[model samples]
Each structure stands twice: as structure tokens, then as C-alpha cells.
Target: MTDIPNIPFVDLASQQNRIRADIDKAMARVLDHGRYVMGPEVAELEAELSKFCGAKHSIGCSSGTDALAMVLMAKNLRAGQVIFCPSFTFVATAEVVAWLGAKVCFVDVEPDTFNMDPKALKAAIETAKANGEDLAGIIVVDLFGLPADYVSILKIAEENDLWLMSDAAQSFGARYHNAPIGTNGIATATSFFPAKPLGAYGDGGAMFTDDDELAEDLRSILFHGKGTSQYDNVRIGMTGRLDTMQAAVLLEKLKIFDSEIVERQKVADRYTSGLSDIVTCPHVPEGCQSVWAQYTTRLPQGLDRDALQAQLKDKGIPTAVYYAKPLHRQDAYKHNLIAGQTSDGVLPVTDALSLDVLSLPMHPYLSDDTQDYIIEHIRGAISDLS
Candidate 1:
């Protein structure tokens, strides 16, 4: 405890400095244009993002949470309809379903990819059906920048007649089998929550789709259901337009996203090589690539996770828990959640996972010196406990 070094979980300044000039220019233009709500920048960003993600249309919304909510609303998903999701993700993914009064069925995740476990997903759908949960959709979350098993996940949705929505909040730039994410689902939602791989300066998100009808529905629903004018409310809607300033910021950030993705891969690789034996590292399956939003590693057996974090903190390295608890155990939705269980009532897999995950400081800008410092401390911590 002599001198605590300052190491952030994510260093946005490193990226900010690289595009400071463009950012300033974009801000100046937005200010001079004066269309803060649904400005020209909004359309431009939508176009750019759609093209980037290989989608036919992309609609900007208030935040990633709103983006998900808008899609749910536009689809007319009712309260009693059941939706399947992984309990391993940020709450925003499942919260949207509950906000619409839908039943949430918590699915388990793969210990390696940290994405939805397709086997568990199939079983969950069956479980919901057997229990009369009235399944309507399945949201596939791209956890920690790695795309879920979309190939199989989408197949499950097709067989079950459930809408497939890609919750790509953390995996906007990730790919599966050489195909981009947004185009895979009926609607794909991504967040520009400042810390995301392709974040805006503040809260913002976008929905992408090729279904022209759904796209139009989303557009109307996003702006108070205005057919051609704001006062014309055609359908039930919400005030969820993306801010002009945030669009401007994202446009500039998008310029370097491709390169940033390449750098992210290198950083992830370094972490795996440097610390693979010390703990369980994230695994990117064959034909899949992640943007490396968080280089999470599982704690060694019997090692105290809290003590490990304290040790890393003492040495100028930082860490985080992606989620310390599963959604089924959470107070908000515990009443409605259907945990993955066997016919005789067994869920040892999920029971073991809730206590093991830890996210290390990960971003494209992690320097070699910083990486070495972090690795040294992490190794020391793991070694000390033994």
C-alpha cells in the first residue's frame, strides 16, 4: 500500500487524442448546423454504420438500451410472450424484454467464448414450451465483442418460429464465418456507450436491418410514430432519437474503426499468450473474430477473486467483473426467470459459472509497458495465493 498507481479499466484518452482534430471539427459543424434533434449527422451516421455492418438500413436511437427497446416495441412483443437470453451479459439485454412485460428465460453461456450456449438455448426453448411460456423471440448477445454462435442460434430461431435479434452492443465490429453481425438477424442492436469498441462521446445506439418493413416500423416508432410530421402519431411510439452531437462524434470514431479492430486482435493475443496458463482465458472459436472489448480471464480454482483484484490494484493493474451474479438470481426478474435445469432439477453448470469470471483491463491502446506491468502483477497475485 505504499503508492497506488492509476490504471483505468479503459483508456479512452488514447483514442481521443488520435482523433482530436476531427472531433473538434465535427463538433463545430454540429453546433453551426443547429439541428440537435434528428440532424443531418444522424442520417449520415446511420448510412455509414449500415454500410460498415453490411446491413440495408441502420436507425440511430437514444442509447443501446433504447435501441433494444425500440425493436421490442416495434415488434409488438407482449408482456406474457417469453424471450430467451443469456444471464452472463449486461442487464440491458434482458431488461428490455421485462420493460415490455415479457417473460425472461435465462440461458447459460459457454465457459470459453462467453457467448450464449446454443445447447442450453435449445434446451431452454424446449423447457419454456413444456412449461407453457409462449416463446416469441430469442435475443443472441455478442458477449465481450465475440459474436455468438449465430449460425446455429439463428437455426434454432427458425425451427422455433421465434424472432432472432442480435444484441451486438459489445460486438459491433466482430464477425462470424466472415459475415458481419448486424445483417444476420431481423434486427441487430448496438450501443455507442463511450466504452464500446466503436463508441460515441456519450450515450447512443443504432438498430440495423434489411427488412424494409421492420426498418420503417422502427423509424416511425423511434420518433413518436410520425408518418411525415412530428405531430402525426401513426403508431405507439417513444421519444428515442439519437442526438446530433453523438452522431458527429461517432462519425469521426468510425473512420479509424477498421484499424482499431486489427489492433484489438493483437492485444487479445498478447493477453492469451502472456497469461493463458495462469487462468482460463477467453476463447475465440474457429471462423470467428472478436473486437476484444474485454479480455476477461477466469480465476484459478480455490483463488479468492476479491483478493486477486486487490492484489492487482495494489500493483497498478486494474480488473472488473463482467457480471458477478446471474439474472435468474437477480431481484428484478427472479419471479419470472426460468433457469436452465434438467428434468430432475440440476443446473450444476450455471451454478459453477456465476462465481468464476473476471475481466482484465483491455482496450486497443494498452501499451507494451502497461501490459508488462499488468502481467507481472497478475502472475505475482496468482503465484502468491498458491
Candidate 2:
């Protein structure tokens, strides 16, 4: 293999170089104001986020996990109620449900889009109902950067009298059916975890909602459940505020976020065009636009994924597995109920996906030459393994 520089999994440096001056100026203003917590920048960012996604309200928080938890807290999620979630996703999605003493029933996902399967969700709700368990809500994750089947999931939620929350942590900049992601579900939560499409310098997240009462509840819950002032606590809450400095950084990143999304789609198009015949490329349904948070591909059946990754590394190509194990298979969530679990007790699609998904280097700055090199090496590695 020819020698080449190691490619970045997500190039933050290049993005910084593009907006360094604006970032510096934004940070300087925050420093001069001396209101590191809930300062002017925080409000400015929240307003901009709401405008970007067409949400009536946007509440900035400390992290993605906190953003989800705060919503659960505001909704008063309690023990014994079950909330359905996809098993093939980050633990944070289910973790917040457990934190509130609620049961998390794991659901399967679509084999192609990798988002929660609506059929599986409906089956889970019926199964829980037959067992006399209380059904509360559903948290549908937009896996990778593509929005889930909200059109189907929302109908199911309405029929079952359950609310819906979208985990848009990875798909914040994406769109679904000509509408922005944050406007689909009852409330949407997104992350700014430095690796996301519209990332901040450090940990940050926000919640978007058109519900006025929910928005007010979230604002109160994020700051010790304050009624009017911080000293006057009315309900149980935590310190979940986003730092002003992180908000300032995010304000700058949000400026170029739309342009970055376009660049990411171009890179994804190149990958699909170059490698679709060799591997199963990601699928984006009509009227949906993925931000391409991670360009994940499914390896061919019987292909040795470990061998392919190792061989790619030998050629200075970096590769990663988004999830080598589904959440239901993890030790922490082994005992959770899996939707559509029969005598075999497995989610067929989620289990299969866990063993095959591989993420390549993805970022707006990924040059065509670098991407072509990565694609060529992937082809070579797969051919050798086959």
C-alpha cells in the first residue's frame, strides 16, 4: 500500500480555522460581560436555534443527556411507566428514561435506514399492554443523520395516546418531509457535542418545542425548578444550564452550519457513487435530507469487518464502528424487554446491524482526493478479504 497521511475521523481543526476570528470575537464578548452562566450569548443562541429549526422555543442545556433528561423531568416521567426506544443507538437515549425510574423497552430498527422500526414500536406497545404495563411515550432516535419515519411513528403515538420525543442529537441540521427535524415530534432534543454537525467547542445541547407550557416547564426544570427566581424553588430540578462560553462558540458555528451540511452531503454522494457496488450504502428516503453526521456503511454478508478495518488502517485510512454491540446486548441493558422478542428473544434487524455497521472519515472539509483515496483503499481491502 502507498504511504499517506492519516485522515481525521472528524476534522474540527479545519472548521476552527475557517471561523477562528469570529469565535475569538464571540468569546471575547462573553469574557468582557463576565456572565459565564445564562448570559446574553445563551439567549442569542437559543433564538437563533429556534429560527433555524422553526421551533417556537429553544432551551440550551449543559449536554445532550441533560437536554433529554430535562424534558423527561418536565413531563414528570415516573416509575413503572414504560418508554419505548430503539436498541441500536447510543445508551443516552435509554439512560435518561432509567434515570427517572421509568422502564425502557428496547425496540428494533429498520435494516436500511437504521432508524426505529414503527412496526416494532406498535408491537412493543401491544405487548406491554397485554402484560398490564403502563405505556407512557416513545423516544425515536434519528440514527446517524437521517430522520426516522416520523409520519408513521406519530400516527402510532396518537392512536396509543402517547407523546413522542425526537432524539435529534445527530440529525439537528436534517429535514423530514420538507419540515425541519426539531418541528416533527412533540419536543426535540439535539446535541452540540463537538462531533455533531452543528457542534460547539464543548458540551452543549438544546431542546425545541412549540408547546408553550412545556417550554416554560423546561426552563424552570433546568435551573432548580425556579418559579420566579433562582432562590425560589418550586419543583425538583437540576443545574442543567448551558455555559455562556459554549453558547458563544455555538453561535459562531451555527452561522456556517447550513453550508457545512451541503458539503457533507456532497461527500456522502461521492462515497455512495464510488463504493455502493462493494458495500450497502446508507439509504435516505424521499423528502428527507440527512446531515451525514457519520458516513456509516454495512459490510457484505460473510465479510470479515475486523480484517477490512485492519487492512484499511495499514493504508493510513481510519475507520470506526458506530456500535459493535446493540444496547440490548450490552451488560447494562441486558435485562430490558426487546420489542417483537419471540422465543428467540432477539431483535433480528438491530442484532444484525450491530455486527456490520462501519463509519468512515466524514466531515465537511473531507477533500475529494482524500475521500477517493479512502474509497479506493476500502475497495482494495474488501477485494482482498473476499
Candidate 3:
């Protein structure tokens, strides 16, 4: 019996190794400067990120959650104001809204892209208005590295006079209609958690926007809402500034982000082709590019998704469920949903996705051999159930 090599869900070490020298230099420079908080690297990274995403400004923050919170704080969202977002995403997307005392009306996601469905968003707005709720804005999450349908969502926001925020936490490097993800909405927020496609060494995030005034407000909100000087506090804020060390690391990573995105696409192409026949593979809509944050596949109906996960584990291949339960179904949020009604009656698509989806190992550095092993074991697991 031979021991199979354990495959990581995200191979950050491989990426780090590829650019070890550059990363070392970036860090060493930060250490020498000894200005760890809001140092030069922070502004340098922000400028570089703005250029990369074609935004006028990018404000660095402590985390993706804070980035969202800062934008909402800048807007001064209050209780009774409703923000529409898909229930299929990480809680951070809606958690910020809740923290700001704003109502979060959960919407259903598209069946294929796992992104916020624009039609569902429109329906949610109507449902909220019918309940006499004060509609405030929309936060479209780019779930699993694919951008949401921004074309229709942007139009809907304009029609209703609502702020549209792009939660590009997983889709930062992706594109929609050939435009970078960050520039499509009024504001875009992204995470730099270690597992993300363009992660830093630790927790970090950034907000991108073309609006000069909004950008200024975000910057102020990120730093205790200081007016003109650090001592001059103009409004309420939080400690949400990104660490200079993380920014230094990100600057090195950003240098190769484009090439890495291309590599991720190649890995996704292989997974889609190999696993499509056995299980439902991911679908990237036309004119959109995913960073392949997680190569999730849905198990066929009647197959126990958990059992298959266990089988893959025994084979030394790791698997995870992105969200075994959608946010609306989670205990904390169940009370938020009207008894017998959600925005679209039941959020059918989000409910179904929760039961069947499983995420396999994914990253820019996934090797062909490891993927072949993964596909073979997946087929074996399915066969055993049959």
C-alpha cells in the first residue's frame, strides 16, 4: 500500500515559493522602514490596486468585512433601510448591513453562476416596498470567483435610485464584459484573506471606486473618521486600516496577479471538462472570467454529498462545502425572513445549492496529476453509491 500525497485546498506555498525573492525584499523593506501602520506600502499598494482594477481610488482596510462596513458607514445606513443581497454568500456581505442597523432583505441567487440574480433582486425590492420597507441599496456578491450579473443589476439600481456595491471578495481578479470587477458598481470591496486568489499574509481588504467624494469618505471611515488631522474626529468610525506589512506582501503578489488569473482559468477548464459528465461542473457565463476561487461541483440528486466527501478524504484529497446552509436558513437570520415568505417566496435556487454543492481543491498552482486523481476518486465514489 502506497500513501497518497495530501493535496491542499489552496496551495499558497506554491505561489509563495514562486515569488519568494520578491516577497522577501518587499517585507525587508517594510521592516527597515519600521512604519508598520499606514506606512508607505499601504498607499503604494492602494495606488497600484486602483490602476489594476481601473478605479480612481482604492482604500485599504483591515478586512473585507470592514471594507463593506466602512462603505455602509460612509452612507450612514440606519434602521428601517433595506439592502438587498443574495443569501448564498458569506455572512460578511450582509453582516455589515445588519451592524449598521440596516435591514437585509435576502434575495435568491442564479442557478448556474451562484451569483445574485438581478431578477430576484428586483423582486426583493418590490417585496420590501410592499411591506413598506425603506429600500436603501443593493450589494451584489461575486460568489465563488464569478462576477454577478452587473449589467442588469446596475440598471435596476439606477432605475430605483439605490446604491449598488460589488462584493468582489472572491472575484477580485475576475472580469465582467471585459471590464475589471471593481469598476462595475458604485463601489467594490474585496478580501485578502490568506485563502483568496490574491491574498496577503494575513487579513486585509480594499474598497475601489471612481467617485472621488465617496473615496474620501471611505478613507475617513477607515481611520476613525478623522476630519483633517488624526486628532480631529469628524464622525463615528472604527479601527479598520490595513497593516503596512500586509500591503507590502500584496504589492509583491499584485505583480503576478494577471498571470496567475490566466493559470487559474486553465485549472478551471480542466476541472469542468473532466467532471462535467459525473457531476454538475461550474458554469462561467459568457463575457465573464472567474479567478477560480473554488472549483465547486454539485453532486447529482439522491447522492449523499457528505458520504462522497468522506470518501475523498480517505483518498487524501480534501473537499469542502462552500455553504452547507444559505444565510436565510441560518439560525440568526431565520427571524429576519417573514414567516412563510422570502423575497421570492422560498429562495428555491439557494436552498437547492446548499444541499448539493461541494468544493474541491482549487488554486492557480493545482497540478494536472493531482486533478486527475481527484476526478478518478470522484467517479469511484459516485460508482459505489450507484
Off by over 4 Å in 1: 1-4, 338-347
For residues 103-209, could you state the per-residue lDDT of candidate 1 as single tens digits?
88878788778778889889888878888777889888998899998889989899999998989999999988998778877999999999999998889999999
Error of 2 at 332 (Å): 1.4
RMSD of each: 1.9, 1.5, 1.5
Cα lDDT of candidate 3 equals: 0.88
> 260-375, model 3: which lDDT tens digit per residue?
99989888888888889989999888999898888888889989887888888889989999898788877776555533444444789998899899998998888899889988
Q: What would the per-residue lDDT of candidate 2 be over residues 254-359, giving only the tens digit for each residue?
A: 9999999999999999999999999999999999999999999999998999999988887788899988877777776544454444324558898888789999
* Shift in Å, residue 215, candidate 3: 0.6
TM-score of predicted model 2? 0.97
What's the ranking of the predictions by TM-score, best on top?
2, 3, 1
Q: Which rank order by lDDT, best down to worst?
A: 2, 3, 1
Tell me the spans in candidate 3 whose CA falls farther than 4 Å from its real position.
335-345
Clashing pairs in 2: none
Question: lDDT of each prediction vs. the true structure?
Answer: 0.86, 0.91, 0.88
TM-score of each: 0.96, 0.97, 0.97
Candidate 1 CA-lDDT value: 0.86
* Model 3 TM-score, 2 decimals: 0.97
